[model samples]
Structures are given as C-alpha cells and as structure tokens.
Target: MPQLITAPGEAVVNRYRTSVVTPRVDAQVVKRHVQLGDHVDAGQALVTLSSVAMATAQGALLEADTELRRVKQLGRDVVSEKRFVTAQVAYQQARAQVGAYGMSDRQIDALIRQGDAARADGRFQLLAPQAGTVINDPFVIGQIVAPGYELLRITDESRIWVEARLPVNEAEWIMKDVAAIVTVGDTQLNGKVVQLHHQLDDTTRTRAVHIEVANPDHRLHPGQFVNVVIEGKAQQAQQGIVVPKAAVMRSKDGDWQVFVETAPGRFEAKEVALLRTAGERVMIDGIAPGTTVVARGAFFVQSEIAKGGFEIHNH
Candidate 1:
C-alpha cells in the first residue's frame, strides 16, 4: 500500500482568484449596486462614486473631442499640420485621463454622446473586474475614499488553498501534484499538492505544503481547520504483514500489540510496530509469517483477557 502522511491544515482564500476593488481617484461614494455577500459577474457595477477630478477630466475630454472633430472637418490641406497633431494628442490624453479615473470605455462613449458639459456630473461606477462573490464591502454611501483605498473584496470560492505543515523528514517523500484528502468534520474533499515551501518554519521546523482544493459548493471557507492526508512515496519499501487495522489495539501499557492465539481458545498479546496504513488495512512488523493472530474483534479479546485478570505482556 502507498504511504499516507496526515497533518493538520487550514483553508485559505486562493489569492489568484481574489480581487480587491478600489478607486483610482479620490471620490465620495454615491451609491452601492451590490451588498456584501452578493455574487457579482465580471463587468458588473459594484458602486458609484462622484469625484471633482473626474469632472475636470471629462470636461477636458469633451473640449478635446470638439477640437479634433473641427480639425478633421477642416482637412489637412486647410489646417496646419502642427494644429491637427495637437488636437489628436489632446483628445487621446483626455480619454486616457478619464479611463485612469476608473471610467470604462463604454462609459466614455456614453459621456461623449451626452455632448453637453452640463451632463458631465463626475459620477461614475466601479465595476467588478472578475466574476466572484462580494466577500467584503466596508464603505458606505457618502463616505470619502482616497485613491487605492480598498472598498470591497471579491473572491471566487469555487476553489481555495489549504496549507498543510509537514515534518521536515516526512516532507521529503512528498511531491507536487500528489493526491491529498482533506477532511472537514464529516465532509471529505479531494485536492492536489500545488506547492512546497523550501524554508522550514522557525518554530515548528516543518515545511509548508500548499494544496489546491475544489470548493464548488463553497463548503470550505478561509480560516477553517481541516485534517489533510497526503499520498506520498514510501521512503523505503520493506516486506511486512498486512492486516486489518482493527486487529491492533493499545495494551494496558499504551503499546501497540495484537492478540495472538497460541493454542485452542488460548490468546496472548504480542507487541508490533506499525509501518503504514491504507484505508482499513495497515502494514506492520515484529511478527512472523503464518502466525495466527486475531484479525477481527481485537477489542473483544482484549476485554476478555482483562476480565480474566491476565497481564497482557510479551512472553
């Protein structure tokens, strides 16, 4: 059976799928299009803001558009080459300025359609850059937010990351893309090893292993604790007896041992070393081949021996 390394892990948001919504210009929140925990699609409007800087840029863009149009109608033969070039550059700069203020190209086209300067209200909407659920929305209407101020956070919860810390020695057998099983309470999730940290933790001296798990139903959440069993290559393969896990039990002295039937209806306890486990079966050492040992109902035999006041020790 293949080796399984179990460790405690934590579920965290996949940074690559998370998006932070912020404004490029200082603005006052005008209204919110989506609330916290709402699922939003890419290009969906999230919030509207009003900025004085946006108004100035929009007004300039309108002026530059009019100048460019007039220069085009006049023709290169009529207008000076320098004048035509200046108008074209000014229009492009104006468009870029508004775009930098978080206005989409569609919105800029709409603004141009309005044509009148009075209609340029400096109000624009911030849209979701990707499809995800709104995990956080900290700003309220009428709140003033500066450039790069995080107003909302969106994350695709369909997939997430699990960070598992493994002992340095055991980590050697682990490799990227290995299969892993993550248990959260009664639920089990399948995952794959995505990364392995080279540096060991300062205190634990364990390497960090990152596993990517599919969370289609969003059952796994960030900061949730889980048990991870990673499939790894065996350090060294050796011959051993494979038996049901129930065959082994802890003795009175807390050592792992199995009940061996010495003769007819006679049983004795013998210590054994556990090697590795796969599913319900385990490989163990310290026992000879063809040795008749209890493969099932080991606990019952242990209890029966205790009731008879017999000390469970090796011969």
Candidate 2:
C-alpha cells in the first residue's frame, strides 16, 4: 500500500525575532507602552526609561555647547588656537556620549537645538526594532532593569516551522526539500522539508527534521506540539503492497502471518514483514499487488490452515 512516514514534533515560531534591550547602565522603567501579545510596528514606542547616566550625558552636552559658544564670541587672536580646538573636541565628545546612550541622530539634533531645556531630562523611549507581535515582556512600571537586559521579545509569526524527530534508522529516508504535512489540532498544513540534522539525539536516538509552513493568520505558535507526516518521496520509488491490519495475525511462534487465497476456497498461510501501521491499515511486503487476499475473517482462515483441514501453500 502507498504509505506516509510520520513522527511527533513541535511547532515553533519562525526565526525572525527581535529582543528589545535597555541601553548601557541601569535604568528605571517609567512607562510601558506595549504589553505582552501586543502587535507592534517598526520604530513604535514600546517603553520609556529613566537613566541617571543619560541625565549626566545630557548635562555634559549642554555644558560643552555653552563653553564653545562663549569661546567663539572671542576673537581668534583673543583666544589661542589650541584653546578653541580643545573646546571643539569637548563638544564633539559630549555628542558622542549622548549617542552612545541610545539617542538617535534626529533626537540628538533636536536636543542640541532645545539647549538647556533638554538637559538633565533623562527620559528616553525604546522603540520596536521590527514589525511583530510582542511575545515576551518581563518588566514592571517601576522595575529597575540592568544594563543590556532584555525587556521584551517581538516575533514575526507570518510563517512557522515544525521540528520533528525521526528514529535514526529512518534517517536514510529523510532528505532536503521533501514534502511533509504538519497536523495541529484540526488544522493540517502542507510544508516543505527545510533541514535535516546530521547528528542524532543522544537520549532519544532520533534525528531532527525541520519543516517550514506558512501561517499568515498567526494561527501557529511556538512550543505547540504537533504531528508531522513525512512523505518519503524517494523511498516510494521502491514500494510495497498495502494490506488491512486485520488480515495479518500473530502466529503461536510470535511471528506475524497472513493468509492469501491462491484459488477458490483455497487459502495459504505466509509470514509477512510489518513495515508501519496507520490507523486500521498495515503496510506489508510479502503480499503481491492485485492478488485477491482475505480482507475479512482472517483469524478463521489462519485457524483453518493451522488445523490442516485444507491444503495450504505459501504465496
């Protein structure tokens, strides 16, 4: 019978993720504009923070600008060239300090224009790096976040992947660019095999197979377990005949046996190899295609053959 290889797996959000982090030193979360599960766009404000270091940087910028302006008012001869150059360098360093504090170029320009009004404010906004839904947010309004700490996570859910594990023995059947199906709840999606792991999982003794599927409506989520049905397109080149599970019975010797009808009312008992079972169907190899075989009452046929009441031959 035509068959499909299946394995259990988990659905994961696609690789596009953005981690929102606080700048350099410790900062207090003053406001949270976005919450968990909120959809955000690129450059949208997600949080507001207050930093002492940012206050100091802004003060220095204001001080440097004041000194540079005061020195410029003096004639070139009145101020030594070395003194003017030193003031200019101080102003540039102050700008660099604010830039390092996570202030964008436009914000820096506006602050420079605002002069003392912008000094010591220290209020800064953290914007989303990409358009995605917020999946993780671990901050409170008054929380103090350490330097470089991740405040939130944004994930693009337009597409998702299923990571399935197959036994090492089945590794030979897995290949790149194969067709696969992922089933989650009542939803079944067609996916493409995107990756195959070279190493086996030490504990499970299974290899990883990654299948990517489209989730345009954001229906699939990470950490959701699903079933993966892999179509062994290459393995199908060498095929086997399919039979009903009831047609195959276990012999007293612990081997699987099936009865095939060679002629009218004449049956034979043959041992068959079990490949894989899906639902009520079993895929076997010893049976030939298009040959009439007992689909029902197989146990009686096996009993009749065992009793030697009828002629039995291997088909």
Candidate 3:
C-alpha cells in the first residue's frame, strides 16, 4: 500500500434528511403506506392522516359552493347587490380555507366533483419530500399526531460525510477538493475534502475536517468509525526526504535527531523534523535527499557520542 497520512473518523448522515409532517391540525395517522428502510419517491404518500380541521374546511367549501351557484342563478334582478357580493366573498374564503388546510388543487377539485358524497373526515396524505429511503417512522396507524409532528425521516444515503479531528498542525494539509481515502474495515473509498473548521476544539486542540464520500451501495452507515488517510499534495511530499526509520532517534531533549555521515566512520547527530512514517521508513524535513547517513547503526552512533567519544552536533 502507498504511504498514508492516517486519522481516525466516523461516518455521519448527509445533511439532506427530511422530516415528514402532517400539514393540518388535529391529525391522526389512519394508514401507513411505508415502513422503515423502504425506499420511496418524491411526492409518494407515506401515511394517511384524518383531521377535524380538514373535514370542517371541506364541509364549508361544499356549502359555500352550493350557495354561490344559487345566488348566481338568481341574478341582480332577483338578489340585492350586497347579498350577491357577500355570497361571492364567502365562496372564495371557503376555498382558500380548504387550500390552507393542506388540500391540493387536484384534491379540492376531486372533492368538489364528489359533492355531498365526499365525506370531510379531514383525510389527507402525507408525502415524501424527496426521493429517498425511510430511515425513521415513529408513528403507527391510529396514532394521534399534531401538526408539524415528525412522523417519519427520509434520507438519501448515497452521499455521506466522514468527520475527523486532526491535529491542529496537520490542518493545513486539508484543502477543499483534495482527495482523501476512507477505509471502513477492508473496504477503501475515495473521497474529497469538503470542509475544515475555522476554530479548533478547546478540549482536544484539534481541527475538524469533513470528507465527502459516495456510498451508493449503502455500506457506510452513520456512526461507523472509519480510518481516513489524507495524502499531502505532491509538492509537499517531495519537499520531505524519505529515510530509514532506524536512522531517526529521540534526543535527550525530546527532539528527533538523525545521524548524518560527515566522513568515514564519523557520524554527526542532526535534528530533523519528522513528518510521516510508512513501515520501516519515514519522511523527514531539514535533510537533503540521497545524503549518506548511519541508517542501520544510528543507535550505536548515538551511544558512542553520548559516551563522550565526540561531542554530538545539533545541526
């Protein structure tokens, strides 16, 4: 496998989750067309709700409609102007009320066609706002629900975010649109850096990075912990020199040092910045690439220098 800059992260649901609601007041779920995990289309009915407010709206519409027709037939000669205007206004108000109660134009037309046979039990269908799978359905048939109650939650899981808290110093590498790898168990997914938080966590001192990954198969789920690898840009990687892991050692001062060979059997300890590690090798800065170093006997060199054979050099 290629060298990776690894971080721990977890999968999260995309922000497009929608809450299905009954648009009218005093609604009770009478029928449920979809259950949890079922995929549904936009405008698909998920449940049928019965409401007193809807029933009243429908009844008033029918009454006002009938009265308007009767007054129109009577003409100005038969009915006073004030009475005629009052009847017209009442019919318009009733129609608007039915619409405000969540009845669609098509539904209102259908009800009008049914006339008295259309019972205004306040029956209305709650539809899916978008095409997605039902992830949550908290209501059962015969359950009394109120307006704005979240009856169900629908989400399109094809796209998701992998949120990771990275060390504050490493935050600079997470640029928007940069490619990242998300590993869920044995599966590896390709994604891109979508976001980076401006502020660091006060407790962890780490910056949050969000990687957007495609999960068309739905294999990645929310709350699943995964491994994320963000490879630095090509130029950044080139700037760091790769050396044997054994060549790097910790100094007494807690700084990472490397043994650079200045002459035959003569090694000098030079402080180097450790960048990334891969297997038995590491990438470091402040060292020229291809320079000779005590790769295998670095620890021996450090011991010899510590014994006062020669004063260790910091450079």
- Sliding window of 10 residues with minimal summed lDDT for model 1: 306-315
lDDT of 2 by residue, 1-315 (tens): 334677888987666454555656678999999999999998888888889998889889888988899889995879999989999999999999988887766777878888865556887777787888898888888999888888988887776788998887775677788788888888888898888889998998889888998888766788989888876755454356677889889988988878877787787778889887764678787877787778888887777767776764452
- Candidate 2 wrong stretches, greater than 4 Å: 1-5, 18-20, 64-92, 171-173, 195-207, 231-237, 242-273, 276-282, 291-315
Listed in order, each prediction's TM-score against the native is 0.88, 0.72, 0.68
What's the number of clashes in each of the models? Answer: 0, 2, 0
- In model 1, what is the error at residue 91, expressed in angstroms? 0.8
lDDT tens digits, residue span 53-162, model 3: 88888889898888888989999899999989999999889999988777777778888878874677689777777988787788878988777777888878888889
Top TM-score prediction, candidate number: 1
lDDT winner: 1
**Judged by TM-score relative to the true structure, which candidate is superior, 1 or 2?**
1
Instruction: Look at candidate 3 and tell me the lDDT of residue 262.
Output: 80
How far out, in Å, is residue 12 in model 1? 0.5
In terms of TM-score, which candidate is stronger, 1 or 3? Answer: 1
lDDT score, candidate 2, position 6: 78
Off by over 4 Å in 3: 1-5, 17-19, 22-24, 67-96, 167-173, 197-207, 231-238, 242-273, 278-282, 285-315
